[model samples]
Target: MSGALLEAKGLCKRYGALVANDNISLTVAPGELHAIIGPNGAGKTTLIGQLTGQIRPDEGRILFRSEDITDRGMPARVQFGLSRSFQISSIFPSFNAECNVALPIQAKAGHSFRFWTPAVVIESLRGPARELLGRVGLGERGATRASVMAHGERRQLEVAMALASQPSLLLLDEPMAGLGAGESARMVAFLKSLKGRFGILLVEHDMNAVFALADRISVLASGRVIVSGTPEEIRSSREVREVYLGEEFDA
Candidate 1:
């Protein structure tokens, strides 16, 4: 609790002949924004899956707030204050934005969806759901159905839903995946505003957003971390330049 908010030590995952994540170790300090950048097939997805309990590591330990949770399932992890947002938007197409977030709020409150009533109709769930929608810059769009919202707005809805559980550590996998320049900039600003409030482990491909929002960065290549350091340090690293950023990184 006093040290790293989330710690992964010697994490390894394998699939027959291929090693997805090899001895991966990283620490995200309390309220720190840590970014993971890598090329395709660099095992970023595998590592994120292991962290969120979607995939189990072949060998390692995962600690959250000083407690080991290597074996916890996804739901258990969410209950323990670890929440994840996927690369693709996961929202209820038929539900309004407020209802979408309220469902997670209900889930986090240990409620069952046995009732046929909509989540937004439940006064108790609607208040906090609306608050979450405002927190993610969707305050005015609460009544917009997911099917009618733009792609970027849908992604914002996903984040609001993730936050409905009040997670201590947020694993964001490519929040900027399919956004246009303006949308991406808005998202980067939103994430920047969240820095120091959440211990964020961001797996992103947008180098501009990554460098702008990350407190520290880790570069993964061939299923292993090649370097982890501050943005300036990473930018100057010859290894990162050659393998990922390339010679025209600054240009």
Candidate 2:
């Protein structure tokens, strides 16, 4: 834990009598890929919300890079090098990929997007935006409008935007969601390339992707961690198989 880049301790969120996340605790070591997996209503999103500071937990604490950030807001957390991508695409449909990525870089540099001409299209930010796009495998697609790109490309763009903040930890909420077989494979390869570059907390339903990318995985069920271990350990666990993986999950 001393070397952990991110840590969640006893995270709990309740909606009246229904507990969304109950006593959840997990850690992401520096440059480690930690995957969170579970079925429907497993509170994965709620936990992610708390981690990203979009939602406050009823009881819990979050540490980022050895700093306590339980009460921090989204902007404050971003300042501390924590960034995230949403489950749904949160890109600018009308703008091109470069501009979408530039927006975050501009904001992080203490510039406002009030003036469309200057703030939105800064010559300086353009370089970094394109660099981020390249990191996410969208180097040549920077000129493409986000609205016209395929879903997989849009997802990649979202990640490029997330990286604009230069985060030490990236919380990815289902980056592989809504992709075809080929697209999914491409995403898996992209994520594999990012494995040791930064700490990644992945919340995904794709077992193959999870198994391929995670250094360790935490399986959630009924608002609690059913088990946490290496991917091979999780794949071989009887409890995890019965609760989430199922007998048919070869991964």
Candidate 3:
């Protein structure tokens, strides 16, 4: 929090006549986890798209580590250490876990398309990949096929792959989606351990995970930020209760 790691100011995005984001603004600090939560069609993912440069904002600016990135494309932003995951599962189904993790490092190591040589042969990639896998608690499972691993391990593998990029900021779009109780719990624990290392912007539907991990919560409704507050404030907020969280609980 000493210096804001990411800053989105007055971000506005529109599609035809529809306003997807309305003057949204927020900041992420180093090693802090911030969450964006909302129901379907509420523009949570749209906001994420704007934040990570997947979608450009009609107005407003994005700054990462003090650099203005308002117009930078996805690849440029990612190269500057902004990493993200999708709502759906993201992995190399055919690649083993280590290979999957190593690929990102290979890309960063400047040998991404060296198909003539084995990827693992590049020590720059393999060493970092193995270390990242170990950091995420997948130390022994690196050799397993990604598809053959359990659902939770696959998710973990995705995380390892993301980390392999050496990102300073991580944008997670529902990493816990489709996970059962045990898998979800493990994912939560894994996420908790990642705090204070990277500025993480987490988009998740699981309230339990959000509450447990978020240092701050921003609630969106109909493409606008309705509320932003700490977990206790969010849990006790009448606006949050009346709008979405309460409904999620009742259902």
Candidate 4:
């Protein structure tokens, strides 16, 4: 079996008296899709922040590819092939979708951003940018401005930007947020197509999408992982149902 692509041990983060993450630990195996689900204010965002290097854990070790990266900053982590998508859409609103993605491609290629030069004019960047857009189902929308695109398309652009880094592990924070029912289904399908291509650590509130896409699920409650199991096991757990899923959950 493939080894872990990312691992967190004894992760703890605190904000004054509030414990955002309490000694949480988990692993993402190579090419596996691991989803983290919890109710509102369950510390899911904090956990994702720690993984993406946006917030440091007060105590813990984060390992990627068997190397210690606990102290690495965001840029360093990206350079190490770890990328993230935020809870909200993060894209250059004024730029066309292709250019927005091209910027990351240029960065990943080690070229400094050339603000004076139009990104599309750079053949090396635009070609791959269009390809990435296609991967995220925004192929025909490449020339569309991000601000003019629908919310769902903007989210798709964010995913394409994350992929430009060519990451081994992708930390996705609430990719389904703000998506309508149809948009959420399309996003789920897109994410499913990406499975086995890269290790995904998904943080989402959409249980349907979570159950449909995850290979394994980790339920977090009050800053701790209450349980980690397959979809079936999670659905059957009394504690999980009471604390997070509730009796109303069909399965």
- Reference-based lDDT, residue 222, model 1: 88
Error of 4 at 117 (Å): 8.6
Tens digits of lDDT, candidate 2, 1-251: 38799999999999999999999999999899999999889999999999999999999899987789998899999889999985444687999999999988987876455556774458878999999999888999999998899988898888888888888899999888899999999989988987898899999999899998999999999899989999989988988878854335667
Candidate 3: lDDT of 93? 84
Pairing residues by index, what is the TM-score of model 4? Answer: 0.93
**Whole-model Cα lDDT of every candidate shown, in order:** 0.89, 0.89, 0.83, 0.89
Candidate 3: what lDDT? 0.83
Taking every candidate in turn, the Cα RMSD to the unseen true structure, in Å, is 2.5, 2.4, 2.8, 2.5
Residue-level lDDT of model 4, residues 40-151, one tens digit each, is 8889989988988999999999999888999999999999999997534468788999989987787887756554465444776888999999999999999999989999
Assess the local accuracy of residue 84 in candidate 3 as a C-alpha lDDT between 0 and 100: 84
Candidate 2: where is the Cα deviation over 4 Å? 87-89, 111-121, 245-248
> What are the TM-scores, per candidate, against the unseen true structure?
0.93, 0.93, 0.90, 0.93
Tens-place lDDT digits, model 3, residues 1-251: 22899998898888898888888989898998999988887888888898878897899988998889988898788789998864225587878888888877867656444654663455556677888889888999878888788877777888888887789999998989888998899889988988889899998989989999999999888778899999888888887777774365431
- Cα displacement (Å) at residue 153, model 4: 0.3
